[model samples]
Target: MTLLLDSEEGARAWIGEAFAPTARQWQQLDRFGAMLVAENARQNLISASTIPTLWVRHIADSAQLLSFDRDNEGLWIDLGSGPGLPGLVVAILCDRPMLLVESRKRRCDFLRAVVAEFDLRHVEVAEAPLERIETRPASTISARAFAPLDKLIGLSTRFSNESTRWLLPKGRNAVKELALLPEAWQRMFHVEQSRTDAESWILVGVGQIGAKQRGK
Candidate 1:
């Protein structure tokens, strides 16, 4: 796959062919995008300037995560899922059972409303911080613009086992963030170029946290 999607048209085209959403899924996404814009008027769900490029910037950016998750996995968990960028987007496009963890009340309300609106029975909204939520083995855990690499791992390690896959979109900070990790963790994750932006990058990894020794 090409590393970077240079234009809005390219990103949109890539997402359509890459995921190939059903008619119903496309409807859900279209509705969700409209709802997101309406909700943004009420509160700061997303930046106003990006509204024009919503399809490529938000929807397609979120959809690109699916390319990394070929197996569909078990339970997909999204931490600090404010506005459900990839979480709701993923649930809308796929049948994977998902949990969206967000601590803010208003955001949680919005997320629940979307869930109800779409009747997404497989998706659950956890209105709490990651530390407060109960632990369950996560087949895939994703966080976008969440905490720093070390802090995120510190908070979420309990939910991961050896087979767990961590997909973190760190944007331009991907390489710098990965470098800050302990040597063991640095070995676990490798950065991948993002399809949505040439300057952006994603940190992808698989393994139980702390399993690898610092020097080994």
Candidate 2:
């Protein structure tokens, strides 16, 4: 579903939440957007179709992720964090440490540029496949447009713990994917509607997801 851009500016108005960014935060978001726009022309950081609705589709979609963390402490891992999205967005929004995992060298460069530009001390970019990369224990994890639910579980298993929660943005197919997951994982996860897009849903998983592959 294509997101129709509103003239109101910023995603806070559209998200229907009490999200408020200081002037500095908005400026930082603007710089990040500028960097994406500039680099996207050279490397396709984001889809060409999303340029107009970038704020609502990307920034807002990413920003709302922080609301899921009850502790909001420890590290937050963003797997396959293409162009930063929620990982950088969450890092800029709060003071918690964020680990952004990306495989491509170019994307990692772009993320590092943003971190340097913004002086984001809380953000770290890991440039490798999730399986090969050594992952720190994370309090929560997020992935956007990365992989299917089952495959995501397979990749993220190493980073998760007894308390680690998973936040995945499943646009319109949340129900179908939930149905496809193994029965053991059924009890551990639930879906929540996205505040930005009504058609989108955020899948939140608690505890361990796979039973058969336990301790693997």
Candidate 3:
């Protein structure tokens, strides 16, 4: 594979040796700016303003979700996969079947292009709203900057079984969101410092709808 090196020599070197097998993916992520910018110009996906911080805001932010679990089997779903954050990146790094669900046709087209451009075999794009799709229980479900915690959990309920694990990257409101979960839904999380910010965290846990509401 042609090594598409990053402009920052140190980052390029680290990505090459550490992410050796995924070097091509690293290259594609490195070129994210150009692709996003090009797509944004035509009113396709993300806005051009986010391009400046694409590495930290998009790539690294998504990559950190991989630290959540070691299990690679079973389906992994990313909801509201706009511009493919933690979903696409996790799919590339982890050995799991990845499904990216998005309602918009334009974003889905962009996601497909990214998958094709990187020749990513483990990833698939589904063009449908989360509520409308028929999916089996996913071992892992993730979302980033998509919706508030309560709403996300409610929507995720459609695809989660007792065994499903959730990996959500949240900002300052993580703690607040955790507080809102019903008391019966046991949860544990740690505040890991993020690469882009001092207070961000990647939260992971398995939870079931409280027994009182389980039958609903």
Candidate 4:
């Protein structure tokens, strides 16, 4: 695979020195990447074609979530964590408890392996669909390239509370999706251009949600 970003100790050092200023958890992040690639060869978790772009596409993409709440505490959950994006990265960079929700057995195994390899004390992997897992109201919930905005909100309704913040890494269709949101939702969010892709965007929202409803 073409190496878009460094995958060695140097890369870890670079990420630690550059992005994760408060923490030096790059070693764990690197191990997480390796675990993803190794398991991906057996079954599809992330697109195999994106292997070459792991650094910018996966690592940097996930790391950017940190910019949202640098001092975030409480629990953070990553829904549909195919290859553990912002969840694993967040666990390494921040001190909060983190959970990765994935239904596929193979992917869950891979996540567990990475967590073990890196000795990530605060990160846990739940090998069940998002609907079945029980989580307290999260301080932050991140969904990376998981589902459409409306659908994601529907699916993650259970985990959202008055204090929950949503961090969604979306693509070119973000604005269009935002326009389509129901007016009754009564929330405020900002759209920022992605650092890795010009056509992509990151959606950040914080506010109280309406009463909880059954998710799809």
lDDT of 1 at 81: 91
Per-residue lDDT for 1-216 in model 1, tens only?
655665677766787888888888889998999999999999899999999889878988888887898785699999999999899998888888999999999999999999999999999999988889999999999998689888898888889888998999999989998987788888879888887788889899998775445334
lDDT of 4 by residue, 74-181 (tens): 888899887788788777777789989988887788778777877788988998877788757888889996788887887786787767788888788888888777
Worst 10 residues of 3 by lDDT: 1-10
Candidate 1: C-alpha lDDT: 0.88
- Clash tally, candidates in order: 0, 0, 0, 0
Model 4: weakest 10-residue lDDT segment is 1-10
Decide which is better by TM-score, 2 or 4: 2
Q: Who is ahead in lDDT, 2 or 3?
A: 2
Q: What is the C-alpha RMSD of each candidate to the true structure, in Å?
A: 1.8, 3.2, 5.1, 4.6
Candidate 2: Cα lDDT at 77 = 89
**TM-score for each candidate, following the candidate numbering:** 0.94, 0.90, 0.81, 0.84
- Candidates 1 and 2 compared: the better one by TM-score is 1
TM-score of model 3 (CA atoms): 0.81
Q: Score candidate 4 by lDDT.
A: 0.75
TM-score of 2: 0.90
Rank candidates, lDDT, best first: 1, 2, 4, 3
